[model samples]
Target: MDRDSTLRVEKTTSLKAVVKKTYVLDTNVLLHDPTAVAAFKQHHVVIPMTVLEELDHIKDRRDKTVSREARIAIQMIDKVVDNASPQDIQAGVPVPGSTPEDVPRGTLAIYPDQRLIGDADVPYLDGTQDQANDNRIINVALSLQAENPAEFVCLVTKDINMRIKAKGSGLIHVEDYRRDRVLDDIDLLARGYEHVEGDFWSMISEVDTLREGNCTLHRIPRKSLPQAYPNMFVHDDQEFIAFVQRVDRDFVYLRCDSRDSLMHKRFWGLSPRNLEQAMAMSLLDNDSVDMTVMTGPAGSGKTLLALAYGLHAILEQNKYSKLIVARSTPPIAEDIGFLPGTEEEKMAPWLAAFDDNLEVLHGTDESCHGSITYVKERANIQFKSLNFMRGRSFNNAYIVIDEAQGLTQFQLKSVISRVGADSKIVVLGNLAQIDNKYISPLTSGLTYLVEKSKAYPHAGIMHVNGIVRSRLAAFAEENL
Candidate 1:
C-alpha cells in the first residue's frame, strides 16, 4: 500500500475505536428529568427537532413542573450551542461542565430532518395518528441508526408506548431513563419494621434506660439490633415495640415508654388499628423526625394517620404553627378542564379527602357540626398547590403531601426543599395506586424519598401493610 493510504487506514481505525453510541432523547425523558442531558455520561446525545418543537409547546404550559422542565432542557441546549456557529451546531457541541473532568466526553447535536431517511413510511398505531410527534422522534432514531451502521443508536424515553413503537420500527436499543429509580424490586424496599428474635425484652432490660418527658431511651448492643432506621419499629412476638432512636458501632438506642403504648394513645379521637399504624403514629408524634414517608395499599389509613398527627402537632402539641396539606392533582379518569380560583380555592376539589377525614375526626352530630366549624376556623390550616410551592419556604409548619405516588423525584425534591427551619414534612402514598404515566411504583418520588432518606438521621419511612378501612376493602386489595 502507498504511504498516504497507510496513514488514511490508521486514521479510520482510530476514528472507529473512539466512536461512541448516540442516544436520541424523547421529549418525555427530558420532561421527566431535566438533568437527563447530563446523565448520558460519555455517550453522544441527539435532540430531535421534533422533541424541540414539543418542548416549545410545553414550555408555555401553566403546569410549572413540566413547563419549567421543558424550559430547562431548552436552555441547556441553547447554552451548549450559544457560542458555536451554525456549522458547529450542525456537527455537534460539547456540553458545559463545572470542571473539565466533569464534562461529557461525547458530543451533543440536534437532528433536523429535511426528509425521511429511507423508503419506510411511518406506520399507523392505535391512539397515535400518522405523522405524530413520537413517530417523527422514532424516525430520527431510525435515521441515526441507518447513517451510523457501525455505532449503536438508542431511543431514550419515559413513555412505554414510544419504546414499544421504536422497537416495532426495528430500532433495538430502547430504554427508560432510570437515574431516579432507587429500587427495581418493590418487595426489597423498606417496610419500616422488623421482627425481633430471642429474648428481646431481656436484652433491653439490661440496657441503661433514661426517662425524658414521655419518651424513654435505652441503649443495647448494636449486634443485637435488627436492620433499622432512626424512627423504625422494633418488635418481638411478645408485643414489645420500641422506636430506634439512634445507632452506632457499639450500641443501639431505642425510645419507648411502654410496650403497645402508642397503639392506645389517641390522636384526634382515633387510635391505631394495626401494628404498622401504631409505628406510623410514633414516628409522626416524634418532633425529632422531620421527614416521614408512608407507603401502603389503599385503605391502610396512611393519610388519616398522617393528618391526625399533623393536627395533633399543630393544635395540641404546638410543635408547629400551621398544618399545610397538599396533594398531586393527577387526572384520575379524565382531566376536568382548567379551574378558576386562587391557589387554595383551586386545590379545594383535590383536597376532598382532607375534608372527609376532618369530618370524621369532628363527628357528624348537630353539636359536633358547630365544633367542626369552630375547629376549622381555629386550626390555622392551609391548602397549597404544589406548583406554587417552588421558591417558597415554610418554617414552623407541618406539611403533609398526599398522593405522592403521582410525583416524580424532581417534584418531591422541590417540595422537600421548601421545608425550612423547625418544619416537618410527611409524604403519604400508595405505590400500587400511582396515577402518573411517567412514573412507576419503583420510580415514584415516594419510593425514591424512602430509599434515599432511610439513612438520614431525621427522616423516617414506614410501609403500612394491613388494611384497616374495612374487611371488604382488605378483600379487594388482596384479590384485586
Candidate 2:
C-alpha cells in the first residue's frame, strides 16, 4: 500500500493498544477485598497515597478482619514494587495474582496528593470545603481523566456517598466491587426445601420402600421430581415430610422416614417449635450433610436450633470432638470503641445470642442450673472471633457461625476454608438484620454460601420462617 495509508494504520493500532481504562480505588475497596488490585485484569488500577495512609492507620487495630485485610493489601503492593526497578515501581508495576498462572495483565499505579494540589481546573470534592482524603482521591481520579481523555476513568469504592460525590464531580464511571455477589436479589435465593401442594405421595409411580439400616429409602422416577439435592427436605399438604437420599438420572431415592423425629425428640432439653426449626434440626442431625446455611428473622430460632444441634452432636452423640462458635461483629450506627478483655471475653458481647439460646436449651430445672457451664465444659465449646480464623484448620468439630449476614463473602470464605476432616459447619444469619454498611442481603456471606453450596451433595440450606420466640416478640416482628 501507500506510505500514508501504512502510517494511518499504525496510528490506529497504537490508539487501540492504549485504549484501556483507569480505575481509581477507594480505601474501603481494598479493606473489603485485599486481592482487588489483581481483579482489574488488563486495565490500570490507581491507588491514591491517601488510601495507603488509611491502610497504615487501620493495620494495627484490634479488628482482625479489617486489620488483616489492610496488611494484605499493603504487602501485595510492597511485593510488586519490591520485584521491580525504581522507575517501573514509580510509573507502574504489574500486580501479581494469587497464583503464578493467574498473573494480571493490568498495571498498578500509585497517585500522590501532590499531583492534585495546584491543579487550577480541579475543585474540592462534595460534602465539605476542606481537603479531605476522599476529596484528594477524587482529585487524583479527575487528574487522570484530564490527562487521558481518550480512555475511560472510573472510581471504584464500597462507599455509597463517595460514589455520589465522584459522579457529581463529572467522573464518567463509578461502581461497587461485586465480584463476590452470588445473587441479585436476596429474597429470590434458594431455601433448600420445596413445599408441594395437594398430595405428593400419590404422585409417585412404582414406589419401592426398603429398610436400609436405620433409614427407610423410597425409589421414584426421576421425571417426577421437583428440583432437589441430597438431604434436601420435601414436604406436602398432607404433613408428610421426607429427605432426599440420592438423585440419579433415572430415579430419585428418598428416605421416607421422618428425620424430623429429632425435632419432636428433645435436644439439650429444647424442642423444635415450628416446621422450619424442625427442618433445620433434621439437616443438622443428618451425618451425611457437612455444611448448612440457615437464615431467618430475629425471633425465628436460627441460633437456638444451631446451638442445640451443636450441643447434641458434640455432647450427646459424640459425633464431633468440640463445638466452635464464631461470628462477625459489625457495628450498627457508630463505633463502640475498643473492647477491653481477652479475645473470648471481647467476643462475649457479639455472642450474647449464644448465651441466651444456651439458657433456653438448658431450661429451668434446678439440677441443670449450671447447664451453660456444664455444656461449655463437657462439650468443649469454644468461642472465637471470625477475624482470626484464617490459616487455621478445625478437625472433628461442629463449627457454628452466628450472625453471619454481617460478613462479606471474602470473610465467609476465610472461615469456611478452615474446615478440616470430620467437621461440619452451620452458618446462622438473618439477612434482614444485616448491619454491615459494606454488605447487603444480596451480597452477604450467608447468602453467597447458601447460593453456591446448593448443588453440593454434602451441603444443605434452610431459611426458617415465622417467629416462635414469644407472642410479644412475634407481634413486634410483624408490626414494629
Candidate 3:
C-alpha cells in the first residue's frame, strides 16, 4: 500500500461511502476461506504478522488440504502487497475489490503485532503462552480499536473460543467470518421435500395439467409452493408425492409420483426401506440429474443408498464404466504412505463403510467374501483418497463422495469440478457426524451445495432422515 496508491483508491472508491470498519482476521479464517482478505469489500482489512508466521509454518504441514489453503492465502497476500515496501506494507496495500468494474475500496495491511509497546489505554493479553498466536492477533485488534476510537474495529475468526476471548478482552465488535455462510440456521436448509398437512391437491384451487412423454406434469401457481425450487419434492400425508420438475416466475411444474411406484424402485438387490430412501433413490435414478446431494443423520443409510445405486447403474443399467468412491481422510490418515499397499489399499479403512454396505447387499450369498470381491472387480470399483482426486477427470463414471460434511466449500468445489462429461456424482454426508474442527452443520460444503444447487436443472438434493440401521442405533440417534 504505497501512499499514492492508497490515496488513489480512497479518492476513487464509492462504496467506502459507508461507515468503514477495520477487520483483523485470524489464521483459522484464512485457512477456511483463502480469499477472505478481499471479503471486507470497502472496509480496511488487517493481517497480523503473527498470522503470516503461522501460515508460513502451516504451509509445510503434513495435512495437504490445510497446507494447500495456507499456500493459497500466502500467494493472495503476496499478490496484493508485493509492490509495497516493508514500511508501506505495515501501513497498507491496495487490493482488488469484488470486480474491477467496481473501484477498489479495501486496503490490506500487515500489522506488526509482535512489536507492541505497553500502551496503558489498550488492554493486551499475555502472548507468552496459552494460545499465543490467537492472543497476539487479538492484541492487534485491541491496538487498532484503541487507536481509532471513532471507527469500528472488529476481530473476525471461526474459533468460538477466540471470539469469546476477544469479547472478554473488551473488544466491542467480534464476529464469526460469515462470508462463506449460505444460511443463518442449519435447520432452514432445503429438505428437498415439502410435507403438506393433508392431500397436496386440497389447497390447489387452480392448476393446468399436461403430459410430457410418459410423465404427467401439473402446472400450479407459484404462490402454492412459494419457496419451491427445481428438483424439490412435495409429499402429502395421504401418500402422494410430486417432484418439482422446474420452476418459473409465474408457475411451478411438477411431475406426479405415487408411493407404490417409488417404493417399488430397486437398486442392485436393495429396495427402498422407507420413503426417505425412496426419494433419495428416485434422485439417484434420474438420468437427467447429473449430481445429487444427500444429507442426513448417522445410520440414515446414505452410504448404502449411494452404493446400491452406483452398482445398479453400472451393472444393470450400464450407465457408466466404473464406480468411484472417495472421501476426505482424517488429516492424520494422510500419512498412509507410511503403511500401505496401493492407494486403494491405503484408503480401505476410511472407505470400509462402502464394503459394509456391499455385505448387506450380498449377505445371502454362499460365500459373502467371494461375492464382494467379484462385485468389486466386475463393477470396476475403485477407492480413492480425496487428496489425489484433483487434476483428474472421470468420464462415464459414477462417483460417491461420502462424509462430505467435513469439507469446506472451496475444497468440495475443487473435487466436484473434476467431473467430466457422461459422469454423475452423488455427494453423501451426515451433518451430525462432521469431524472437521473448522466446519459446522451450517458451514459444511454439503450444506452450501444443497442450497446453491437446489435450483440447478441438472442437480438434485435430498435429506434421508430415517435411521434404519437398528432399534438401538435409532435410540442412540434420538436419545444420545
Candidate 4:
C-alpha cells in the first residue's frame, strides 16, 4: 500500500556512444538519396574511397538530375566534415542532427579503400577485377569486419548485384537502403478508390443527407468508412458510386454521383472507355481539384485521358491560356538542343505521345495533319522538360507531367511547385513501367505523391485499372 511499493525506480548517471556498427555505403545509395548519410541514425556511416571517386566523376554528368544529386551528396559530406582533420574524418565525426536528449546521434566516416592492406587472416575480394569500384567498396566492409571483429559491419547498397556479391564474399550483413521506402508491398499502394461488396448503403446503418447547392451530400459516421480520404471513390456492385468530397474528425462527406454521369462526361470529344477512366475524367474536370495523380499499368489510357482533358480545358472551356505537357526524359535524350529548332521541337521526340493523342482527336478531320497543327496553335500547347521547369512559374496553364514513376520525391515536388496561380497539374505514371535503375514502385515519386496527398482536399488520385489500348496491348500489360 505504500507509495514506494507500487513501483520501484532506479536512476543512474552514465553515457555511452551509440556508434556500435559500421555501414559502408555504395555510390548508388548516395545517388538515390543525397541525404542518406544521416539516415543510419545512431550508427557509424562510411563513404568508401571508391564511392567518393564515383561521385566525383558523376557530378559533371550530362544528366542534370544525376549530377545534381551527386553534387548534393558531396556537399552533404563536406558539410559534415568541414573543419574536421583527416584523422577525424577517417575515424568519425558527429552528424548534424541531435537526439531529444541533446546528444549527437551518429557519426560519419570516410573509409579509404585504396589504403587497405591485404592480410591472410582476412577475406578480401579482388580489387583489380571487373566492377573494380564495387570490389573496393566490398573490400572496405571486409576490412572493417576483420579489424573490428567485435563490432557489427554492414554494406548498404541499392544494387541487388552488389548485395549478392557482398554476401558471396563472406560479408554477413548487407542490405538495401530503404530510407525512402514507403511501403513493403506494392499491392498496398493506394488505388484512389475502395470497392464495397453488395450495396454500399447497406453498411451504413445511419447517415445524414444534406444539400450543397446543386449537389447532394451524405455525411456518414467516420467508423462506417474509417479508411476514407478526400477525393477517394466508393463504388458498389449495384452501380452505386460516390466521390469523397471531404473528411472531418467525426464524419465523411461524400458527393453522390452515378456511373452514367461519369461515363457520359466528354473531354475533347473523347468519352470514357471504362469506369476507371470515367472517374479520372471527372476528377480532371473538377475545378476545385488542383492536382490529379494517375497510376496504372501501360496501355491503361493514362496519357490519352490527361491529353484529352488538357485539350478540353484549353480549347473548349477556355480554362487556361496554355497546355503544357512535360515528362522526364533520358539524360542523353535531354540534350535536345543538339538536334532541333525550338525547345518544344527538340522535346517533340520525347513528348510524341501527346501528338499521338492529338492525332486521335483530329484523325477524322479532312486533313488530319492540318487539324493537329491547328489544334496545337489554337490550344497554345507547349512542351517543356522537367529539368528547366525549375525557377519558373506556369500561370493559367494546364500542366501534364507524364512518366512520373521514374522521378524522386524531390524532383516531383519541384515540378508540382511550378504550378502557379489558376494552374492545374495532372501527374501521370505507370508504376509497373518504372524505368529508373534506382526506383521501385514502392519508392517511386508517383507512389510517394499518391500516398502523401490522399488527405488533402484539393488533390485527387486515380489508378486506371483496365488496359483499354488494344487487345494485344492489354495482353502484353497483363501477361508480359
Candidate 5:
C-alpha cells in the first residue's frame, strides 16, 4: 500500500468499488469466489479470453468441486456473451444494473464513444496467450493498464507470486479477500492451549498413571515433559510440562489404552499400525485432551483411524452425543455450487470418503443381523460441508476432518473453534496427495496443527508412515 493507494482507498465510497476500480479478475480468483463478478457491481471487470479457455480445459475433471466451478464459469460467460450487442457492446455484458440486464453481465467497454475493441485484438495485448494461467491473468491487467494509462489497473489473485509479478509489470495487484488470508496466530491459538510443568522425562513415562487421576510426580528433564504430560490437560498450569517436554527429542510417543484403541477402530475402521497410531490413540482416549491431529500419506489410514475412533467414542462408549465430519472438496479455488442439488447433495461426493470408512466398519456380511441399522441406531452421525459450518458450535461430540490437506490454516482454525466443552476434534489428512497448489504439505492446515499443537498437553500430533489400505494403494502411495 503506497501513499497514492491509501488516498485512493480513502476517497472511494465503498470497499467493493475500490477493490474493483478498473480491476482484472484472474481465473483463479473467479474459481475461488464464484460470486466475485457479482460482488464487483458496476466496475469494469475483465476476464481474459484465455481464462475462459482454461476453464474449458478443466470442465471435465472427476472432482465434483473443480468441475462444478468450471461449468458455472462457462454459463456466466455465455450470459455475458448473449447480452452484448454489436452497437453498444461493452465487453460481453455491462454488469447488471450498471448497464442493463438485457445488456448481459460481465461485458467491458473501456470507452463507450471510442472505437470498439475487437475480439481478435484481445489476446495480443499485454499477456501472451502461451503464458501460464496465472501469468496470463497478470498480462491482462498490464494490457488494461497500458490501454487506460490514467486509471489504476488492479489485478486480483490468490496467488502471492502473481501479485508480486503484477507489481513488477507496473500494475497494481491485490489478493482476493474472499479467499485470501489464512488464520492469524492469535486466532489459531484459540483452538488449543499449552502449559509446561516442572519435569519432562519421568512424567512422560508415567502417562498411563497420570491420566488415571490422583498422582503426583516431579519433572526429571525439560526434554521429557511433552511425552510425560498427560494428553488431557491443556491450560496455563500445563505450560511448564510441555516446555520441559520440548527440551527433549523432537518427537515423543503417547501411551494408548483400551478406550482409545476401541474408538480408533470404530471411527477410522482400523487399529494401530505404527507407533504414531499408538500415540494418537492415547491422546484421543484421554478425557483431558480436546484436540488431536494425525498426518500421514494416502494409505497411512489417518481418516479411517480417526473415524473409527470417533464412532467408538460415540456409539460403544456413550461418550459424545454425535459424530460430525468435514473435509474440503477441491480444487481449493472453487465454489461449492454447480453440483446440481442442494448443499447436502453438493457435499455428497466429498463425504463419500467418510461413508466408505463407515461402510468398512459395518462389514461385508449382509446377513449380520441388521448391522447397518444397528450402527446407525447406535451412533448419530452427520457429515457437513465447510461452507455451512460458520456460526455453529459443536458440544460434547467427536469431530473428524478428513482430506485436511486442502484446507488453509484459517479454515482449520475456524473448524477447531466450533468444538465445545467436552468435545474432541480429530484432524487427519495425507499431505503427499495434496491437490491444492497454493498450499503444500509443510504449510497446510494439517502441518500447521502438527507444528503448533505440540505445546498443548490436551493437543497431540501423530504422523503415520506405514501403509495398510491395500497392496496396490500402498504401492501407489510409496512408488507413485
Candidate 6:
C-alpha cells in the first residue's frame, strides 16, 4: 500500500481513544516533588506565575530547609529554562509517557482565556480574603477548566481543604500519594498470612493446643470478624494468643507465635505495654507495609518505642543511613516566632520531649547531649525540622515523626514523600492532647497515614499501651 493508502486505512479504522490536556500544578506540589513539574508527558503542565513568586519568596527564607527548597526550585527552573532550545522549560524535562516528538513546553499565557468556563469570574487580585493562596490555585484550575471544558483539569495539591475546595468547585482534584504511599488492608491480607499448613480445620478448635510465640491461631466465624479483616482465626498457646485470617476457602492466615516474634521483643528503656507494642510490631515486621501510626495515652511509651525502633534500625540492623527524628511544630496558640530566641532555641520547647527520650536512652554522661547526638558523633544521626525534610532525598533512613497527631494531611504528605530507598517512617502521638482544632485524632495526618499505608509491603503499625514512665504516670494514662 502507498502512503496515501496507509493514511486512508488509518483514518477509516475505529478505535477508542482518550486525549489528555493541560494540568495545573500548585506551588506546594512542586516543592513537595521537584520532579513533579515534568511529570505530565504529552500534556500541558501549567505553573502559574504566582506559584513561581511564592517559590521565590519561600526560596529566600532564612531557615536552612526552606532556603534549600528555594535553591532546588531555582536550579530546576534554571536547568529546564536556560538549557532548552528557545528556553522550553516544560519540554526539556522528561514527562514519563511522552515520546521525544510529543514533549511539553512551558508556554506563556499572559491573559486568561475568556472563552473558558469560569473566565468571567476569574477573581484576580483578591488577596485580602482568607486562603488567598488556595483561591488563586483554584481560580487557575477553574480558569483552565473553563477554557477547555471538554478536557480534564485536575488540581493536584497536598492541602486537604484545597482538594475539597477543588472538588466542591466543580473541578477534578487529587492529593499526591507519591510520598507516604499507602497500601490497602484487603491487599495486605495475602501478605499478612505469611504461611498456612493446609485447611487446618482440625486445628481450628484446638485453640489451647497452640503455643505462645510468633504465630497465634484463632478462628472467628465470618460473623465476629472486624470489618477490616473478616474470617479471622483466633489462636493461643499456654502463654499468649493472636488472630489469623482465612479467605477464598484456603488456610490463608498464618498463626504467629506471640511471645518470641521480632514484634514482641521490647527495647530496654522504651518497651511498651501489651496491645500497643503488639500492633506496632505487627505493622513494623511487614516490609510490605509502608506507613504505621501509633497513638495512645500518655506514659504509654509511644515516642520512646518509636525512637527505640528507629534507634534499632540505626544501631543494630544498620538498615538506614541515620535516624531522622522530626515532629510537627504544635499548631496551638504557640508559634515558633513567638518564642524568645533563635530557631533552635525556639524549637527547644517542642524538642524537649524528644530530648528527654534521648536522655532516657542515654542519659547525660558529659560526653553527648543526647543518645542521638552520642550516636551521631559516634555514628550518624540526623535531627531536622518537619519543614526541613522538603526537597531532599533520604535513602536507608528510619524516620520518626513525633507528635504526629498535630499534623494536617498536607503536612504529612510533605514529610512522608521524602522517604527514599530502603526507608521506613513511624508516626507517634497521643490524639487526646491534640492542640490543632482543625484536625481530630481520627483525621490527623498520622491516622491518614495509618489508614492509607496499611497494605504496603514495607510498613507496620503498633499502638503503645500501659504507662512505662511511672506507676502514677501509668495511672494517669489509664484513669485520667
Q: Of the candidates shown, which would achieve the greatest TM-score relative to the real structure?
A: 3
What lDDT score goes with residue 314 in model 6?
65
lDDT of 1 by residue, 174-237 (tens): 9998888888798888888787776567665357777877767888877667466677878787
Best by lDDT: 3
Which segments of candidate 5 are over 4 A away from where they belong?
1-213, 216-218, 223-270, 331-346, 364-369
- lDDT by candidate, in order shown: 0.80, 0.81, 0.90, 0.89, 0.60, 0.58
Which lDDT tens digits does candidate 2 get at residues 1-480? Answer: 788876774334444454667889999989888888888877788888889999999999867788888999899788767778756765778776623565447888887655455555765454133656887888788878877877899889888988898889888888888877777777678887888999987887678777879877888888888576677778898878777887877877887646457458667767877777888887888788999898888899888888888887777788999999997665433223466767777778778888888878767858555867888899988888776778899999999988888887788888898999999999988888887888888778778888888878888889898988789998988899
- Ranked by lDDT from best down, the candidates are 3, 4, 2, 1, 5, 6
Error of 3 at 285 (Å): 0.5
lDDT by residue for model 3 (129-217), tens: 56568999999999998889899999999999999999999999999988889999998999988899978899997999998889889
* Candidate 6 local lDDT, 97-210, one digit each (tens): 333554443332212222223244553323333647666767777776765777877776767777777777767655542432333332332122222244434444423233
Candidate 2, position 165, lDDT: 86
* Residues 229-277 of candidate 5: C-alpha lDDT, one tens digit per residue: 3342222322221211222344333332233343344233456765455
**Model 4 clash pairs?**
none
Kindly report the root-mean-square deviation of model 3 from the true structure over all alpha carbons: 7.2
lDDT of 6: 0.58
| Higher-ranked by TM-score: 2 or 3 | 3
Better of 1 and 2 by lDDT: 2
In angstroms, how far off is 284's CA in candidate 5? 1.3
Error of 4 at 32 (Å): 1.0
TM agreement with the true structure for every prediction: 0.86, 0.84, 0.94, 0.93, 0.54, 0.53
In model 2, which runs have C-alpha deviations exceeding 4 angstroms? 1-19, 96-104, 123-130, 199-227, 246-253, 257-263, 329-346
Pitting candidate 1 against candidate 3, the one with the higher TM-score is 3
- What is candidate 1's CA lDDT for residue 205? 38
Error at 132, model 1, angstroms: 0.7
